[model samples]
Target: MFRGTGFGTYYYDVRQVEACDTSFVAQNLSPLECSSQNALSLNHVNSNYVVAMNHSQLKLDMSKYCGKRVIVTVNGEQSNLPLFIGDGCQRCAGGSASSDVWNAVAAPGLDFSYSVLEELSGGAACADGHIQIAWEIVDDTIYNFSDGVNFETAPAEASEERTTSSAALVMSTSLSAASFLHTPVNDDPVQNAVAVLARQGYGDATEASSNNALPTDGLLASLAEPR
Candidate 1:
């Protein structure tokens, strides 16, 4: 989602690869490696709001959104996020959000920092993990992150609808997977990392009857085959 305009729905999780995890670092899947300079950390202590999307499914060029700030609205709660490309996962859209951003928008009693993997995979239903969000790019002319200015409150005129081109609308939809597939995993290191994470119980036990859910069998098989 962008600004106030509605974009297509996508799944989200709060799982993050720790900076010190060697497996993630070797595969270049760590948050620090995947995100831009604007999003250096996902620790709860940092106030920088950021979200990552699977690089494979991201049809647009990374240069367009990286380092740019967007107001992400999830379940009617809003946070400012810097966009970045992340490791890929089947049927997982809007890949992950920082713990701080998750805490800000998540319902009461759901703490991402306490149990990252459980919270991500223990949702009541697959739809519970789905992120119905809307986002809008912050106008760089009005607010700049480098200036050390904080945009705690949205602009007064934020509610007013702004016109976007067909290209922008198309770009929004392209960020998500249009269909679920069981195709063989290719040579992408980011995807290989996803497979490894799955082996570590990422999405192994999630009950997903829906077609949109990630295929656990496919993820496991990726490791068995050579790229």
Candidate 2:
């Protein structure tokens, strides 16, 4: 779910990846909100890329979003490329925003003619590189947005921004499965570190799911593969 101060919310969903000849196939993308009006279904040729957009007119200097998952379409093509969302308003920070959030990712056969940036800014200087998206836990209620999506109040400049413990900004990008598995373990230093970071961002410290927590399967997928 995407949120803004006065604007209403929108939902988005992504398709899953399927095994292809050499790599994975990315199928059609879906917007969660699209279903509200019409049961929007996507048509694609070859599954290749997933997409994301920023709809907030507010400035956005988002965190790195490589290797993350965006929307979810069960039993469909899925891509692991992470997407970085920004302000939809070009006049705003990075020229990314909410209008972008409505349109779905570029699927093989889908037509993503409508763009939030294009709608708001009349056009956009499209960013280069495959986007990496972060996925929210299936059922966990993590709110940090102005509507309590991430928090009651919005972050200064970044959508996911908030004060961070020194360690959070410096924690290793790489982590052992042990880090996630150790959640129920004693109040060890690493666990404590994760806890503080979660809270600093207005997340629940005692919640089993951490908003800061991301899917490690992608990382592990790379590591688990034969060398």
Q: Candidate 1 has which clashing residue pairs, if any?
A: 1-135, 2-135, 2-136, 3-135, 3-136
Name the runs in model 1 displaced over 4 angstroms: 1-48, 54-59, 75-77, 80-127, 139-227
lDDT of 2 by residue, 45-164 (tens): 111222233322112322232112233221233323222231132122232332333223421111122232122222331332112222331222222122212221234435445445
Candidate 1 lDDT, tens digit per residue, 1-227? 23332222222223433322212222232343223445434432132233333334333545443434555555666643333223222222332432223322321111122122123234422334333445555434222233323344334334333334555677666643222122325686546555454555556434344653564557545654877
Best by the lDDT measure:
1
Provide the TM-score for each candidate, comma-separated.
0.28, 0.16
lDDT of 2: 0.28
Model 1 has a clash total of: 5
RMSD of each: 29.8, 25.5
Q: How close is candidate 1 to the true structure, as a TM-score?
A: 0.28
